[model samples]
Target: MTTSENLTAPRRPRTVDEHRAFVASLLAPMPAVEVPISGALGRVLAADVVSAVALPPFDNSAMDGYAVLAADVAAASPDSPVTLPVPEDIPAGRTDVPTLRPGTAHRIMTGAPMPAGADAVVQVELTDGGVETVVVHGHPAAGQHVRRTGEDVTPGATVLTAGVVLGPPQIGLLAAVGLPTVAVRRRPRVLVLSTGSELVEPGSALAPGQIFESNGPMLAAAVADAGGEPELLRFVPDDVEVFAELLAEKAGGVDLILTSGGVSAGAYEVVKDALAGRGVEFVRVAMQPGGPQGAGRLDGDGPAVVTLPGNPVSSLVSFEVFVRPALRAAMGHPHPMRPVVSAALGEALVSPAEKRQFRRGVLDAADGTVHEVGAPASHLLASLALADCLIVVPEGVSAVDRGVDVEVWLLEA
Candidate 1:
């Protein structure tokens, strides 16, 4: 009842670009939904957000000072002062105020709307103050220290465009524009499954030939980080009949079905047995550690399925390479892949003939020269854990000497 019981030879390995383009073509964007502004962080915008009103709404004081006519204070200097009566007081958020008369100054507080006929403001530190009179020893230029209406944002202007990821600054901008609700793309639903009779959960004691299950939790975290809601399917045994039933049950409500293991050229690969000739294609990829990969829709369900390798490092790397980009596209993210840059190889590396290598390394730019961190072994999970980038070595190329410039994919900037 295992995959070995169902007979077939392994298909030819596919190139990385071919698999990537296939996954990209299969993805569709999620629908939009309205959510509270506070809950919209990290979601993509569904519509262009236009400003309802101009920022500031009125001319306001940018400083706490005396609002005066620039013409009256033009000739005033430290040696010869200008004395004017304090006509009225203006504080922030006050709408009842009279226009300033000539030769008189209005005491204004910061953020208070500027009264009519006032062309400039002088700081309190530069004026001699009394109960009703003040002397200005400094002349300020016209329109100085004033925040004009629409200075930050004008009405009918697009404040946020569609497909923009909402972050802290974006939330603040939307709130400042008086928006209490926002339209964002719905989160994609992902179902994660772990396959293998040799696997055991983390808390349970392991027997001989059985290892703890790490792929389920690791891939779930990756899916959530990529903006998908992950549903953890219980580990399926290495029996074709059981796995087929489980797959059918879980595929009902998911946007994607992700599985780890049972796609390689092994004697007892149950996932391959259950999914063989059932609308899914399993093939070895020309990559180390994560050589075995699969993708296609399930037989009866519309959700796409991606089968990754069994090793912990392999599962994570394959998720980063294939599944993450596809999920981002489904969620309407503008940029679906990590940014890549060119860097120098701090050490020499040897690679295989037909496989492009992604070596885990740290990228340092301290002296304006990018350098790699450690060895380029795919099984070195410790190196991958500490790495900020992956140095890409193309196929059929080998022996990159020290100080040679190479391409690096950054995990984060």
Candidate 2:
């Protein structure tokens, strides 16, 4: 079947919001698996994690000091020090000591459990030390220098909620609560392919009409950054039968299929030729660099397929616009896209009519301005690399003067 025969009448060009919502609705969270705590970083929690025990577990000394009753040190001062007999030496990780006597003190190290009948701690630096006797010079109040049980976390409290991505601090908390493993959502398995006859991998000598295939690795990295595991398929030539056979062979275990190139209106578009009538829809989105976009099930086998444009910059931008959000949704991420805000422009800018423009720029938030990073050409990968944000220009607008308020999407925090 021909591409035109498969597609219905061309629909109105979709806005960014409409395309985003459509992609989001096609993705669902993957299954959950229990992973060891040591490798849980960057994985989203599949279930709420509750503290198994109270943090600290018992009252302990926060500093190296002498544990004693507050009344015993009330009358002590710098000039008139009080002497008390040390009945026991308490160190951390030892639980064999007897309770402190009323008139005596116990030498306690930092993190050592506070003995019963001890209501305060006099720091060791303020006392004259000996095996059986010490001189206390400071007056301590009740509960001074003592860490109360459950001060950090109470048992049975929900410490981390579902869909939260685990980081260093969270891993530490889970370890402190005696959890050796965690339940995290499985990473989405993505099958990535690049289709074209005029493309060659990097490090190979290029022919007269061939260029290096940069989109495969670039798209793979993008998928990994969005928390998906990318499986790269061998590059396929401009043949529809071979492309369809390849897709049918690899569609069983993949959660999604992502292809860069060969989905445009060119006559040699193998991906469009093979997938035209097989449940995929190719449309021209109302955006620059990434105008031609396609999405749907791949022969009704895999999860879904998103076909991006052929240009390297266009492929990357399309991933940022479509695939990244879908992968984030499947991983249960709360916020899929980079954060957007308004800022003043440092220079004048022009854009195409009736198409939203995502121009690469550097944000100078300290000076409340966004400066264009480089030339705003859609094929300039260097400009995109240097940019910290994409200054968004709305459709139907042409020129933006310097110092005008504009919308920007921050690439990093």
Candidate 3:
């Protein structure tokens, strides 16, 4: 179903694709803001960038040599060498224009503006490297070794288009075109909150029932790496009332609110309890490991919310499949998803009926195959850590023999 129908709690379970599309529609595109060229790296352009000044700016010397008229140096050779008086020395950045005297040469440096009457430059290596008088050994063609204005780029030319990510090269281009700043889509600010009374911070002594909390910091890191500004909110008491109050207090400041845990079927489902009637809709997606999903606005009006399952691997896989792409798209990213490839399975595997399976794997690139790294459980953090890609098994298929081709989602670019 379309998100415009309103993603309230669904009467039944939702498919993986259906829930993904719904979650993608949750976030509105961030507005554009002007920032300095130095601050534009890693940002996406919101508008086309046109050059105000032509590259090279003016006709300049392309080599450190002597500026001479092409006809003056045309007959110079070892057998009939021509000697010309050097009337002036023109270094790069010289302000006043010096016209090349009809038959005389002007010593010029690389990037120096071409003299008003010069049509070519003769290299110092070919001459005697003289400052006052120089002996030309070779002929120079017309317009040789001289940079022309508007050759590389012209004024009013579109150097960059909208939705292009600004990297070092792009930023350098903007600087070369004399733009001090540019307009780009602003990064989406996200507040990451994880719930559960049994969760405890790492590096501390834990009670008998408490395990170390990981989802908060991990998701925050993921959010930051995906080009979103992330703020971590942890250690709030796992009560429905406290959670509700915190949401109301912190909702208006950020673009998205991401919460993990307490959405599954359990006795202490705090997220499900607090946001059940408010606006967020929790549902089970027809997928492996990360089936329990939630999305919508808090109080039907506040910041967009997406709730994920508590297991470490499940949380990560859910983010990769849904949140990461959505967040990048919201920031105006051109290619929002990870690269995927097809490879043969190194070993046999089984998948549950009517559910898509995502298995951590290591790819044998030379062999054109992938092998599972860890079992299918959602809490297997070690396997996820060692994995370079995720092997995807589609729904409706239960088993596959060795060497069967499967879809692989590469983790790195």
* Predicted structure with the largest lDDT when compared to the true one: 3
- Model 2: per-residue lDDT, tens digit, 1-413? 68886696667887777777777666777899999999899998999999989998999999898999999989999999999999899999888868898999999999999999999999988888666998999978999999999999998999999999899999999999999999998998988999888878889999999988878888888899888999987567888999888887887788888898888887888888888888788888899868888888766555788888888778887788788878887888778777888999999999887888888889987998999887766678888888888888999889999999999988765
Q: After superposition, how far is residue 118 of candidate 1 from its true place, in Å?
A: 2.0
| lDDT tens per residue, model 1, 48-90 | 9999899978899998989999999998899998999997999
**Model 1 regions lying over 4 Å from their true place:** 1-11, 128-132, 367-379
Clashing pairs in 2: none
TM-score (C-alpha, index-matched) for candidate 1? 0.89
What lDDT does model 3 reach? 0.91
* Each model's lDDT: 0.84, 0.87, 0.91
Clash pairs (backbone) in predicted model 1: none
**Clashes per model (N, Cα, C within 3 A):** 0, 0, 0
Q: How accurate is candidate 2 locally (lDDT)?
A: 0.87
RMSD of each: 4.2, 3.1, 3.7
